[model samples]
Target: MTASGRSAALYRTVWRWHFWAGLIVAPFLLVLATTGAIYLFNDELNDAVYPELRFVPPAARTVPVSRMIGAALTAHPGAVSRVDLPAAPDRPAVVFVAPAGGGEPLRVSVDPGSGRVLGSLVYARTLVAWAEELHGSLMIGTVGDRIVELAACWTLVLLVTGAILWCPRGRWRAAGVLWPRLTGTGRRFWRELHGPVGLWTGALIGFLILTGLPWAGVSGDLLQRGSAALGVGYPASFRTHAAPESLPMKTALGTAPWTLEAAPMPRSHAGHAGHEAPLPTDDAGAIAGVDRVTALLAAEGMTGGYRLFLPGDATGVYTAYTYPDRPEGQRTIYVDRYRFARIGPEVRFADYGWVGRATELGVQIHMGNYFGRANQLLMLVPCVGIWLLVVSGVAMWWKRRPRGRVGAPPPISGTRFAGLVAALAVAGAVLPLFGASLLVLGAADLLAGMWRGRVGDAAASGIG
Candidate 1:
């Protein structure tokens, strides 16, 4: 092959990689973008969908949280596990109840103003819950989680390769290259579809992938552990004066700080470990249960939507935490159940190590929750842009694809091809799964080439 042919060969090689990777990632991209966009409006959507359960009239003083929990327990058969406080007076407090029989937890929304049991739903069966599960694992558990992670890894690789192919070298066109041409047909139209959207929103899509990886299964674990090892993550030694409790906050609460998910929860000794004469309430507060904890949290500057997880046993502490849009308002607090005293120092956004703080902030931006509705709209650019990329990509493939074939780019063998494949090592090193797939693809390609050459040799022998 000549110089241009060699370049074409390299281009074809990358094009093949992009083409196959896009096909695999396209479906997942659609699912993620659609579900992610929906989740961005979780508060508004939930309020709209479940107005009776979620809303109440504003009052000068709403009923106590204790009364709200009481109402929830009266309407359901279970102990209160966690109570998600209302953001405003007009919204109800959602009390999560863990059934004595041991199944999915029940969530009861109670009006704080009137202390009325508005309604109940299974914890995992709510619309938001369903969407969350689908978003996390496609509702198929660990295998699905791995698939999603792999898809995410590949999506990043696709972004890199797509940028390479999209940028014109040795020649440039203002119309088809820089922006989509309004006047076009067939491949031109598809190029118009793929080119501009990919050009503009490509970086944002990459941002979404990186931000989301913290919640992924395999790669996420690698990142967390790696960060911890580097000493830039949440400090394992945060000057905890409390007991060395083994239960992590993530294991205890439904939502926790991204940094402290694996860190052990601060614990306090049981007040009623033995013969209990009903231990006297300490200086923390006169009240107990949800009311005391809520008061304590409110006093501690947790004025936003927060959850107060009730103690499960004698040793369990009440964990109050806020996972809001902006990281600056986020805090995780712990209170001893009986003594009502704080266990450890109040964990704020400032407490997070460098990596933790960055990750948390990125997570907020990724979800479009950092700046309210405007933030949501801004983050939505990539989500909608991905749809356009996928549609245009498929269209371009369909219009030009060879008849009765998958229509992958034709292969060429040369030093350039070898060098290009070698260069992918850097990418593979960064993304282990992507690197592994590349190796698998390379091996398969080698085998297929050998098989084709042998068949050709046999045909020549027969003709001679």
Candidate 2:
């Protein structure tokens, strides 16, 4: 084939891959975009919806954090699991309660001054929580999580193939390349819109996907394993001592810094390991430890809105966790319940290894925290753009596709097919779920081809 012919063939093959992948993953992408856009403004939305729970009048003197928790527990029927101190004096303190009878955790808000219970609601039923659930797992647990992860992986494939298809052949034009040609009609209009919009939003969408992969089931595990193997995942201090085998901070408490989610919890030693003498193991000592830790955190400038998860058991440590709007304020400090000594270096954004730091920055930006409201609005552009792309792509297909046909581009065979397979194999290796789906799809394709061949032979033989 001529060079031009080879280029054309390669373009067609990429277009075919893009078509199939988009057709399969567009609905899930739409869901992710919608939920993610909503989640971007989660705090604003929640505050708007429930002002009574989120806001409070500024007061000269506020009650103690312990008093707020006491009022919340007195008003709600559950054990206090965690408390979110208000970032500002005007905001109500939020207390997370785990129901003794087994149900979704409850979020109770308390007035800072009077220690009055403002209101309480089930955590899972909150609007922000629901949006989070839909975004992460589609409210279907592990199966939904896998499906979402697979869709995300395939979206990367879509972006890659779409970029290839969008490459300019000749001199670049303003219309259909940089901006959609508004003057066009029918499939022309949709094509113009889809291609340009995809180009504009592709980078942000890819960043979002890459950052979110750390939270996914299979991909997250792989990323963690890979990071550990490279010695850049958890903090170096995590391996310096024989820490107790405790649940992850996120698992034990409600929230933790992403980098320390898998870091082992350090145990409180009784005057051992070259540390100060441990405090008493009684209830009074626990209370004193809480006060001492809170004071230390305040002295260390652990800002408001940080959470202090009280030690749940004899060996449990007091975890002060916070992921503030500013990435630099992000900190996760674990203090021994007995000695009140920090378990590790106060883990902060600065303490993360290079890979971990990069991930943290990506996560902060992804969560719209890097630049506050501006960040949220900027990220929303890609979310809205992605939705537009999906809609326009579907409309274009509908206009051009023959009736009753799947509208897939012609399949490539020979060397082109081999190249496609090789590309998919590499993607699959990195994204295991995507790889599994590819194997399943390939098997189905092979079976369908055999079936069609059998039917054709049967018809010919009968005529013969």
Each model's C-alpha lDDT?
A: 0.78, 0.80
Clashing residue pairs, backbone N/CA/C < 3 A, model 2: none
TM-score quality measure for candidate 2: 0.91
RMSD to the native, candidate 1? Answer: 4.4
Task: Give per-residue lDDT, candidate 1, residue 265.
Answer: 62
TM-score of each: 0.90, 0.91
- Model 1: per-residue lDDT, tens digit, 1-464? 68887777777878978999998889988988888888888878887887787778887777788888778777776677677887787878888776656677778898877889989877577677777888889999998898888889899879988998987887787777878886888888888768878998999999999999899877777777688768777665643533243555666554578887766665557543321112212212322466777777778777648877776656667878888778887887888877777876787888778989999999999888888889899888999999999999988888888899888877766445556556688778777776788889889989999998899999989953
Flag regions of model 2 displaced more than 4 Å.
Answer: 100-102, 170-172, 240-244, 269-289, 417-421, 460-464
What lDDT, from 0 to 1, does candidate 2 have? 0.80
Give the Å error, residue 355, model 1: 0.9
